[model samples]
Target: MAATAVLQPYNEAQYDHRAFDSLMDVDESAYYFDSLTGYEHLRSGLRDIFMRHGVSDELAVALLHRHFEMSTNEKLVELGPVSSPWPIAAHEDSVLGGHILPHTWRVFENELHPLEFRFIPQQEFQDARKVQFSQAFFEDFRQYVKANGLENVVGITQLDHGRDADESDVQLMEVTHGRNSIMVPAVPSSDVSGPAFQTIWSFVEKQSSKLDADGIQTRHGLCYKASSTDAANDGIQTRHGLCYKATSTDASNDGIQTRHGLCYKASSTDAANDGIQTRHGLCYKADSTDATTDGIQTRHGLCYKANSNDGIQTNHGLCYKATSTNTTNDGIQTRHGLCYKANSNPTTA
Candidate 1:
């Protein structure tokens, strides 16, 4: 007699099909696992089967999701065919840095298996998106993977989009090797209103200290000026009429006179002199003395001497050494102070 063949009914419960229902039905899925032994057995078997077929573990897991309607509920089991093959057509490649796409079944060229289909879960898709280029964080991630012996595995960085999405809805950043693409969240970093820039600035500031003692060479850093007065004044004041007093006893001068990366001096007595000075390499008066002597004296560079008390005094004067009546011999010399023409000698003046 010929051996009788028996066919068994597909037992959805055997491999935990209920888990798939939960995963498909819910917006998010939690991990499920059978007993420890079952988990090990399924994983080993699936890996062996895939290895024999020359499929990668990643691709194999994807195939399970695609063709078998199978998902890990802590262990692998047959869930039967829940859906038809959803092959991803080629030419849909749109990989960019800092972006994410929905996960789905796709066909890719495998080294051993020419054409292979894999189901990339939303999580795996998210993991792939987190890769950043040429960043310290990326280097750190590389070190971590190397240390953990997970060089082939991807790392994730969760981005918090408060109020816009649920607390659980975190965008991820992935770090992986051999990929020249970056996967970021769907939302642009510009759209997300958070302390990301501030955090970056803070990091830059920290790193800047090591590179230069002056710190970041930007004018955006904080600047604190000792008030002309010791009184607590924490309100905005007008830029003008708050000049630096030439005399040390000028008690009216009371507040910060200059902003960051600037300096102040009580030099300009011109009508434009507001008592405050800027290190903009502009000319200003050093004293109320006659135009012949008090000519424009810059806080940093050469001073121009006035020839007369008349308005022409502002025009007829040779540039002199700062704080001195001595004539500057250089022609067209540019310094961090006032701009003026130098006289060859006092006789020429």
Candidate 2:
């Protein structure tokens, strides 16, 4: 039977989406206040409104003039604690790391005070309307998918509205989620043409369901002549599979028989027959007192086997050098290089 597939379609024009301008129209107009109570009420209302539209609490307070200003021109001649040494205004650095000299020095009670430095524009929001809307829409869609248990989704089809329904763009995507997903294509079929257009819904659907292709179970067994030493033989390395080894003369005379020649059996049996022994990681110099000291003498001089508890080990059974002696901790060292031994359970961390 053909495998079943799920299709999810979203039409942007059908939804009653709000305009970007409508969401960002913050009221910065001044309000009239006859009493202290009226002023407080107005301030509170403005703060709530600003916050509802994504404004931060600090920015809302600043906008309402509830926060104190440290760079005000009126503070130039104000009296401050004279105990601190007065540094020249030109020596002072602005927030931008630039040296800014004041316009003039105020003579307050015959004491000179720096006054009126250049004001630099602070950073503001840089996201464009289209980008912000795309991000918001994606986040909302992710939440919707999670809440509705659509985590097993295979693909997505989106229709973006243009000036008219006929000019709309259709986006098609085949997604495989592992660590994180990425955008493939957003350009509509109506806007562009060529090989790049094949990534659309129709093409992906056709490719995913193409027939006459062999499945894993129905695949044929691979055939090739054995190497002289039979060192790097390539065969079907799947579970429950077996390989037949034979000399070239015997193979030719036997007319390429199946399950005929000497059997190497499975991986473990074959590895043993090949005389491959546990390298135990390469021989490293280890002290006699070290726990990992193998005490075996070989052609590579005095070498020690890596500890089994070390986090990273080569197929031969040696621990990685960097894994043992990083900047943070000192691992066990002997004739065998540095060996890392976890004081605590590594799995818990």
Candidate 3:
């Protein structure tokens, strides 16, 4: 049968979040599926997945064979240890057409919510290739944590597009928790997708910390693109799953398009926020880089941070900044707020 996510079955054994995060990057050489022209590469990837799980060589081979059979077969049996007590051995489960396969594993609290993803900034996902994010990406992740249905999903760890060892060249990222987790495939070792990541959590605690409900700080920062002059995709576009910028000449080769800022992208269904700026610990939004005026900005949606000094620009203190309002000082002013008087208009004497 089909499972929500793509994964083999796992035993009743408990899984650790850190261990799962480590699995997100496919081994490239261990995978064996070749729907695409890159079947051998996928096979190599599958081999590494086996090693990551500490599966023996023979078992790995069996899994490969089963994967092949499953790839071709649709009416595979619905019974067998693949359900619960998944046997590490393929030969043990006879009901699985001699090829017992674990249910595909999908992250329940991942991707993005329909409502949330829409709010994503336009520039966030545009050029998925060259995205270097900032602290705001972490903040968005934190909001996702609060909005996530699964309480077990504490926070997102690292988002990368290449090798697991090189977090510097990271682009998109899946989340991590104490118990639940997800996996992603690797792109290339030499190429860093968007050599920049932003971490949005108080601290990286073990499962114990998440269970305790104690929170941590999120340190989010995007990578610095080497001096480059670009004009193709100087704007921003948030796509289905990635945040990219068509960086004109960044050596990192990440999809960087914006001129003066970094890029942060979320799943397709997550809220998108673009043109975010933090000045004096306050987040100010810009219409776009091309926009002449940068002063007109807005504030926190749904929730506001203690350090967030955001508000709409107004001529009076009733809004964000203190504005001067000239009143006759003789009308029925029901609105209670700071007021100013006309320059030459004298009152009753």
What's each prediction's TM-score?
0.16, 0.14, 0.18
Clash tally, candidates in order: 20, 14, 52
Q: For candidate 1, lDDT tens digit of each residue in 211-307?
A: 2221111111111111112212333221111233334332336532332222343343233555433332333433443333444433111122322
**Number of the top TM-score candidate:** 3
- Residues 1-349 of candidate 3 have per-residue lDDT tens digits of 1122333432221222222232211111112112222323212332233333332211211111111111111222223111112223222322322333222221223322110001112343343222222333323332433343221222222222212355433322221111111122222211221112211222222232111122122222211111111224343221211234544334255433322233323221121355554321223454433323442322211112222122111110000001112343221111112222312111101
Ten-residue region with minimum lDDT total, candidate 2: 216-225
CA displacement after TM-score superposition, residue 299 of candidate 3 (Å) = 20
List per-prediction Cα lDDT, in the order shown: 0.23, 0.21, 0.23
| RMSD (Å) of each candidate, 1 decimal | 29.6, 30.3, 26.2
Error of 1 at 314 (Å): 37
The parts of candidate 3 lying over 4 Å away from their true place are 1-197, 203-216, 219-257, 261-349
